[model samples]
Every structure is written in C-alpha cells, then in structure tokens.
Target: MSRHRRQRGGPTFARAATLLQITKLVEFPAVFLSSIVQANVLPSRQYGQLVVDLSIAFIAATVMSLGVEESLQRALAANPRDRAIWTEALASRAFVGLALTLLAGILLVCDQTSLAIVGCIVVANSIYDLVVAQTASLLRPAVPSIFNIAAVIAASSATLLVRPSSSISCLTITLIFSSLRTAGCVLLSCRLLKPVRLSFRDAVRMPNLADRGWRPLVDLTVYRLTNNILNRQGDLIIAGIVAVDKTSVGTYALAFSLTTAANTVFLTGIGSMTLTRFSATYAESGKFELGKSWQRMTYLTAFLSSWPLAILIAIGPGLSVILFHGKYPGLALYLVLIGVVAWLGRISGGGANIAVLFTLRNEKLVRKVFLMAAAMNVATDFVLMPLIGMYGAIVGTMIGTFFSSRFLNVQIRRRTRSSVEWSPLLLLSCLTAIVTAPVALLHRSFTLSICAVVVSLCLWATFSWRSSICPPEISSRVHDVFGKKSSVGTD
Candidate 1:
C-alpha cells in the first residue's frame, strides 16, 4: 500500500519540498542582510538591549498566537475552502494579540523599553506567520515567497536608508519593515482565497471552535514557547546573570544570530511543509504510514543544513573581524561551536520528530519531550552561564537539543516501530566532525579548514550515491540533473 502510494504521489511531494526550499532561499538574503545591519550599526549595549526586547517580543507573540499559526495551517490544509476555520482562527488570534498588547503596555511602563516598537513587531511578525501558513495550506507554496521576498527586500533597503541614531529608532524601522511584510502577505493570502471574505471585525469576534480543536493549539504553543526559550531567549538569561556590559551581551546575541541563521532558514522551510505533507499523506493512505517519508526528509534536512554551517565555521572569523571591526573578538570560535550545535540539531532527529509527531496528532508526546528539554536547558543555563559565561549558554542549548533529539528518537521508535535508516545520520555526524575538527584542534586558518570540509563533503556525496543510506529521491534527482540514467530504488 505504501509503495503504491509513494509511486503515485512521490513526484508531487518532491515538488512541494523543492518549492519550500526555494521559499527559504528567497528569504535568506534579506534576513542575512538585516542581521548584518543590526549587528554592525548599533552600539554593543544598545544591541544587547535590542536583542532582549526583540526576544521578548518574539516570545510574547508566540504566546499570543497560542499556536494558531500552525493549528490553523493544519486545520485549513485539511479543508482549504473552510471559511469558518479561517474566521475562527483569526478571531482567536486577535483576542490573544489584544491581551498581548495590554501586557506589552505594562512592560513598557515598567521597563522603559520601546513598547510601540515591540508591539508593532509582535503583531506584524505574528500576522506574517499566519498568512504564510494560510498560503501554504492552500498549496500555493510560491505565493508566500513573493510577499516575503518583497517585504524582506523593502526592510533591508529601509535599514540602509534610515540610518537610525539610536537602537530604539532602529527597532522602529524593524517594526515598520515587519509590518510591510505582514501587509503584503495578508493581501496576497486574501487575494488567492477570495471566496472566504475575511474581515477585521471577524478577528475580534469569539471563535466557536471545539475543545479538540483548541487542544492542539495549546500543545503546539507550549512546545514552541519552550523551544524558543531554549534557543532564542537564553541570551537574556545570559545577560542578566553573567554579562558585565551590554557589549558582551550583544556579542553573545550576535554569535547566536550568525550561527543559527542557516538553522532558521532550513527549519522554516522544512517545518512549513511537513505538517501539510504529513496530513495530506494520512488523508490519502488512511494510515500513519509515513516512517519512510520522515526518514527521507530527515536525511534531506541534514544534507541541506550541514555544509552551510561548515562554511560558516570556515569564514566566520575573518568575516567577524572585518565586519565588526574587531568589536567581537573570538567570535569565530563561537560561531564554529554554535554552528556545530546547529548542525547536530538537524541530524539528531529534532526536526523530523516534531513534524511527524505533530502530524500524527501525538501532541502529548511532543509537549512532554519539549518540556523536559526546556527544563533541562533552563537549569543548565542557570548553573553554567554564571560559571563559564557565554560558552556555558551555548553548551546549555546544545545539551537541551541533544536531550530533545534523544527523546524524539526513542519516541519515534516506540510509536512507528518501522525500519528507518540511521546510518546516514551517523555518516553525517562523522562528516560534521570531519568538517569542524581542524578548526577545533588547530584553531587557525579557517579558509583551509573550509576547503577541506568542502572537499570531504563532495567526496561524501560521490560515495553516498552508491550507498543505500542516501534517500532514493535525492539520489535520483542528482542523477537526473547530471544526465545520468539511474534507478536508486526507494528503500
């Protein structure tokens, strides 16, 4: 049954995956440029505060969203023409947004942070998330890309144009940029699905969703919030506990931003597609027979994620020195370590687990795993950050990810009990070590190490083609692209 299903729908799935990858590629340059601007233009102290405020806004927005972005996507993907789902989801989302606004206002009064900027950023970013999901749910993967690309380009240009004197001013520009992107995405989403006449008043109205409908939102939100705390919000904890100055705080934040940019892109692209793909598969197959798909996607994610981190490790030092004018010394090493952590995140079964488990409606397991990891991360950060500083925080994040991945692997095994390949993951892990070992051991000449890593990856790819561990879809695509007639049977 699974074989027949794969034979019939594999090409469509492949195309969806490709379009999703293109979406990430489209967003990457703008996001990277924006990060560069944020890192370079501001004073360290101000940057640190900016990082804190931004993180707060992000977390608050996620909390406010109540996981509606993903929940809406999953629901809408199941019934794309369901206007009621759209109205109800948006209504609940707006209610949460209003509550968040009041909370942001209180925080603004107490902390003297720019509430207006944070508020705008939160609303805009959250709206964008929903609209992207909306578009993707309708199988218009490329439409979100158009809106996102335009917004990113506009934001990047505005960042250059405004030349804000203060961090607050810079943040205001950031908010405006996000708002522009949100506006574009919303407009596009609405235009593409015009039968569902959505309105502003509908956003504030009470959603008449059932308890089962709302449960997934809460579960997803918990996992997402905890995950964000582990990855993005930890910098604030580091700042409060260990940082003596704003520069140090900003340095840690910058290191995170630089190292995890690739991680964000890959996850955003892959994550956006997985739920829809998995749900659609279940709808067709009438069973959760997606172990092979999960394995293939996981391996593909590792392949897509590893090399960028390797290159970043290689070029980060020189780039940091040149870009920041030596403001962040030892940043290259930080980038290398953080990059490895990011690489581990991909191969260690984190992304696949989240997508698969969620699609399976195993939200209980997902929440438990993330909660456990989040707790460990927070504890590790508290214990280590003050003792060892920024490295400690990075270590804390790695440790949490490791725990999460390990738990996820165990859960996948227990649930699916299918023969999913792990050798590719093992090989990729070795490749990661090989790619980063030189920089870790000798601590010099990142360019040479980068060349070595690239050569090794090319050789790995050359050899991987002959191995059964490689995903058949990827191997076939490689052959087709290079004009080779090949039949790599799907395992």
Candidate 2:
C-alpha cells in the first residue's frame, strides 16, 4: 500500500485561499481589539512587563512542545486512525508540561511571581497547541479555530470591562480564558473523535530516539525554535532584557504587535494553506505544477499584503496617536520599518522557506536557514541594542530577514531546480512603494495622512487593475466577487 493516500482533490487553491482569508477576517477583529484594549488601558511599564512575560511564555511553550506536533500531524495525516502515535505524542507533551510545572513551582518559591505566572502560561499554551495540531492533522481545524476565536473574545472583553491594574492580573485573566478554551477543545475533540487517554507510565519515559520520526521531530523543533526567536518575540525579549527603560520596551512591543497583527491578518492566511497544497500538488502531479502553484500564490500574497503595507506607511503615525491616546515618538518609523521588511521577507523568492519544508521536505535545510538567520539577528541585536536601543533590535531583524530570505531562495532553487516568477509581484511592490511615498511627509497632519492614504490606495488599485498585475486566479476571483466576467485568462 502507498504510504500516503492519493489525492482526493481537496479545495481549489483559490477556494482554500478565500476560505482562509475569510477565517482570518473573522478572527482579526477580536485579536485587534484585545491588543488595543491592552495597549490603551495599561501603563507603559505594566504593558512592557506584560509583553515580556508573554514572550517568555511563548518561547517556553515552543521549547516544551518538542516539535512532536509536526511529527504527529504528519503521522496522523498518513493514518488518521493511528491511536498509538496520538497517545504517544500527548504523553510526551504531558511529560514536558509536568516538568515545566515543577519549574514554575520552584520559581514561585524563589519569589519570582511574574515568571511563575509565565510558567503556567507555558504549560497551558503547549498543550493547547498540541490539541490544535491534532485538529489540523485530522482535517478538522475549524473545531479549535472556533474555540480560539471565542477565547480571544472572552479574554479581551474581560480585560476591557475590568480594566485590570497590574500586568499580573491581566495575564491571570488571560490564562483562565485560555485554560477554559483548552478544556472545551478537548471535550469537543473527544466527542468528534476518540477519547485521548494519557498513560502515566508513558508520560514519565523519554521518547525513543530509535523511532523513525526522531529526525524530523528534532529538525522541526529546532526550526520552530529558531523561527520563533527570530521572528515572533525575540525583539521584545531582547528589548526587555537590555533596554534602559520599560517605556521603550513597551513602545517597541506595541509597534511589533500591530505589525504582527496586520501580518497575521493579510499574509498568514495564504502561507498556512501552502504547506498542504504544495505537498498535495507535488504528490499528485509533479514539480512543474508545484512551481506554478507557488508562483500564483506568491503573487496573490504580495498583492494582498501590499494593501496593508501601504496603509500602514500612509497613516501609521496618526493611527498610533489615535489608538494609544498619546504621541509615540518613534512608533511611525517602527511601523514603516517593520512593515516593509515583513512584506519583502514574505515575497522573497516566493516564500521559499515554506515551500522547501512542505514541498521539498527538506527539514534540515530549513533548520539551517533559520538557525543562521537567528544567529545573525541575535548578534546584531546584542551589538546595536546597547548603543541605539529599540531601533537596533528592528534593524537587526531587518538584516536577518534579508539574509535568510535570500539564502533560502538560492538554496531551494539549487535543490528544486525551479525558479520563482517574480515579475508581477515586483511590479505590484514597486507601485505600492511609489504611491505611498508622499504619505510620510503628511503623517504629522492626521487629516492629510488619511486623505493621502485614500488617494494612494485608489491610485494603486486603478493602476494595478488596468495593468493586470494580479495573478489570474486571484483576479478572476475578484471579478467573480464583483459580478464581472474575468478578462484575464489563465495559462
């Protein structure tokens, strides 16, 4: 029998992408509200502490999860009914959680209460993520996605209503909501699938390195660790550790959170779907079809992301003042810097890192690329942060992103012997940058900034529409949405 099932012809790329985008659209508001509430209500020092605490929690969670989540997903995808792998994975995660809980207790005894709270978050988030991985593997992601949305809404509502005085209180409320969501997910999963039983004996033992999944598990774990450190919370963590004042950390965290939110909303949706799509395409067809799909999706990602990037550049300073209720001196510069780097990184060589892992199945290569990037990022941050503060962290990240993207593109091309078609994406990016340039001058006047943003978007849209810069698949979908027949033809 084949190790993997034959293609059952899942959702079309366009349909899958559209559904993912819709899902993010529904989720983004709650997430945005949560961020806004936290930023606006908390004092800068408290907010900085909160950011640091959460970053530490996330990093710890990533470490404890042991990258077995991806291994479990791959195993379950091949055989969804495999109870043995499922149980083993859960036991492994449980074992790590238990160990971490003990560490938390130790910290509590040492009077590091904030870190103790983070330790609790680490356990909760790790297990929750494992459950989510299982859901995705079983092709029932909506189960956990719904629960996640509800959890965010509940937590954010409580925060806004209660207006907690301390970061600890806010984090406690968040943990409560998160734990509830985890319980809900477990119950719902048990109902939908088989009940997951964790064996105490299994939980106490270390994983067998002799197992077939060991190599991939290690690779993925390192990849995720490096990626998280470099991209997700590394800046905040470094700033929290190295900055002279909590206010600077808070400012950087706020800017980081906003840009990350925008990224999650616009770019992440498509990237999330690419792994499955690329895997299936390579399985059923060949590298040729996979390359085509990659190009198409890359173009679409660039097109969708450009709008948010432009908007951020145009009105970022004004939006910062309005949302935070104060002038953040470098907030506008942070937005522009982070936004541009993020956009460029995603489109660089058509997001080759993701394609390499999911399509080429080269975990080692992915791990190496990210590790190199992380090292570069850390080195730069350490060198510059003491001299220039938060700006150093951002600049470090920018340099690392550029290097990693370029390195991945070159390595993937050499391995796959395929090239990304970048003409349309390049044109779109150039046009977006050109039109949004004037907004930098107008940023001081909120009214003028807004007006400039509107004008810039309109001009870009008109030009892109007329120039046919969008991928045919996306353009056709857009036309269909507007009840217009597509004039663009696919190859």
Candidate 3:
C-alpha cells in the first residue's frame, strides 16, 4: 500500500517539475502580445524609463535577494530534513525586502534619483522573485498561472485606460501593474501554502546565507550579477552612453522592451524549474551525471527559441514600420538583436543547473568564477560603451556570456556527466544567418523568402530533434508533465 502511494506521488513530483518548464514556453505569447499592446498604448518617455527601470530593478533585487529565496526554494524541494530551513529562508528574504526598501529610501533621500528609482525597482523585484521562488518550489505550476493571469489582467486594464498618444501616465500604469502582480502572487501563496507563521528570530536563526547552503546562494548571486550587467545594464547605459537624446533613447526602449519581456518568459519560467529539479537531483544523488538529461532538453529549447528570433531579426523592422507607423524603426534592429542574443543566452542556461548541483562541494571555486565574470563584464562595459553605442552593450553581453560558457561554465558543467550540445547552436546560427541574408536584401517585400525558409526549417528542427534532444530522465519527465496526470502537478 505504501509503495502504491509512492508510485502515484512520484509522477506528481515529476509533473510539477515539467510544468515549471512548460509554463515558460506556454506563456511566451502572453508576454510578447501584452508588450505590443502596452508599447502601442504608452507614452514614449515613460516607456523608456520603464524598461530602464525594470532592468535596473532586477539587478537591485539580485543584490538585495541575498540568495535567501533560492535557498528556501531548494530546501523545500531537495532538503526536507530541515523544515526550519524553509521558514528561515522566507523570513530572511522578508527582512531583506525591508532592508531593500530602506536601502532604496537612502538613495532617494540623497537625491540620487537614478539610484532611488532603482531602489523602487529592487523592492518590487525582491517581492516578485520571492513570490515566484516560493510558488514555483512549493505549489503546482498552475498556481503560477494565477499570478500570470493577474498580471495580464492588470496590464490589459492599464492599456485600456492608456493610449499611445496619452501622456507618461501610461508608463506609471504599467509599472504599477507589474508591482501589483507580485503582490497578487504573494496573496496566492498565502492561500495555497497556508505557510506557517514565522518571525524574524526564526528566519535569522537558520544558517542560510554563509553556511553550507551559502554555496548555491553565492553561485547564483555572482552568476546573476554577471548576467545583469551584460543584459540589464544595457538600458541604463543607453540613457547615458548613447541615449543623451531623449527621443532617440525612447525609440530604442520601445523595441528593446518587447524583446526583454518575451525573453523573460522563457528565462524566468524554465529557469526556476531547471534550478529546482537540478538542485533536488543533487540533493538525492550528489551526482552531476544526472544533469545530462537536461543537456537533451537544451537542444530542443535552443532549436525552438532560435528561428523565431531569426525571423524577428528578419521581419521585425517591417512589422515595426507598419505597427507603430514608424514610431521607431531603429528600435526594430534592437529587438531583433536582443531576441537572437536572448535565444543564444538561453541555449546556455540549461547548463547552469550544474553549477547549482555542484555548488555545495565547489562553493568557493564557483564564487571565484562568477566574480571573475562580473569583473570582466564591468570592465568591458566601461571600455566598450563609448565605442559602439547601445549595441556595444550587447557586445559586453556576448562577451560575458561567451566567457562564462567557454571558461567557467564549462568547467563546472564538466563536474556533471553532461556535456554541452554546442553543435546545435552553431548549426542553428549558421543556418539562420544564411536564411536571413536574403530577407534583409528583400527589404521592400512584405513576404520574406529568407524568413519562410527559416521558419520551415525551425519547425522541422524542433520536431525532428525532439526524440534526439532530451536525455532519458528529461524526456520521461517532459512526457510525464504533458500527459494525463491526477495528482502531482495539482498543487
């Protein structure tokens, strides 16, 4: 009887993990379509600042999150022996939320407007990340949909009240809704988890930050930090490095906003599931060999995420010209580049699970790699921004991401039995480039020969590669997730 119960519940656990991954793919359109609606409806200045704000806010949250939420989430899945660890992480994260607010307030008091604004973003970010971390780890993936639906509703409501021709109020509406979305998720968490009442003392007592758990915490922070500078810092730097002209910056923001939002769906959605699954696997087996299953999933995601970006890079400018009536053609290029870059970025993210899995054993070594990556990112940004303009920001991203992928990232991943499926990315990129060239030349045509070819190939590649793509566990897990199930993902 006990064995039967375990068998039934086992699928549930597996399905929950898969839901976390699918949520990203399933939710992609929601984010992209919503951004388009908001882009068409919001004032340019507000929209630019909003992009910059969200960008900076994420970075701030990284600093402020202090790895507490991640700690809790992993403990929830992989380490139930210390139940108090979950409570402590939650408490520490909450306390940090307060601290982030205070930190933001100080910058505001000093009249550091950018920093102050960054502070607000951080506070919002901290709340959102914690809410997401908790829900993704503790509840079923559908609960996350409740939060997404709430965000969609809030964003749509804001759009209805705002218009492209309206004033900056549109931007404010968008930001408000984003912040409120975090609050709504928290409400759902309360209802679902009925999380035990925890106090500051209990949270603080748990050895969360610098203890054995600190390894994952440190690796995540530095890795997140490096990515932030490469990706997030681009917007703010645009305002300074090349965005000295208000209208120009605003135009770029319009395009960049769409790409970032869409990419976030994939990054945020799948990233959590990957982290949680790998972390749990690590806890159970202490084997990096298990991550090989994820390597298979990586191939599928790389193929799936790429050509759309290639197509966008091909068609986005024309679409922009028609959509916004040429509100900003330059932005179209930014969007395409960002999409391609994000797809490239995600191709590597599946590998990060190794870092988390190995973190406990290689904590100090992992920290050094991330710190090194961060330093390179900052140095490159400082040196390159003056040279290539906003595009240079992406150069930093490419460089940093490349460095991480080739150097530190690979080393850590080597600890696991899994090897990076580097061929697909190169193959996809080359094929995409070949296909896109003709489309670019045919700028005047409504239909792109290059885009058509790319899309057809993308579909083929995605489907053709599915069986060849996932590792045994990942394939089994994915099937488990999408198939009929009664119990596991019900949470």
Report per-prediction Cα RMSD to one decimal: 4.4, 4.9, 6.1
Q: Rate the local accuracy (lDDT) of all candidates.
A: 0.64, 0.63, 0.54
Pick by lDDT: 1 or 3, better one? 1
lDDT tens digits by residue: candidate 3, 385-449: 66655565666666666665556446556666566656646765676766665676567345764
Question: Compared with the true structure, what per-residue lDDT tens digits does model 1 show for residues 378-419?
Answer: 888778777766777788889888889877877876776654
Query: TM-score for every candidate vs. truth?
Result: 0.82, 0.79, 0.74
| Candidate achieving the largest lDDT | 1
Sort order, TM-score high to low: 1, 2, 3
Q: After superposition, how far is residue 85 of candidate 3 from its true place, in Å?
A: 5.1
Model 1: lDDT equals 0.64
Against the correct fold, how does model 3 do in TM-score?
Answer: 0.74
Worst 10 residues of 1 by lDDT: 202-211
Q: State the local distance difference test value for candidate 2.
A: 0.63
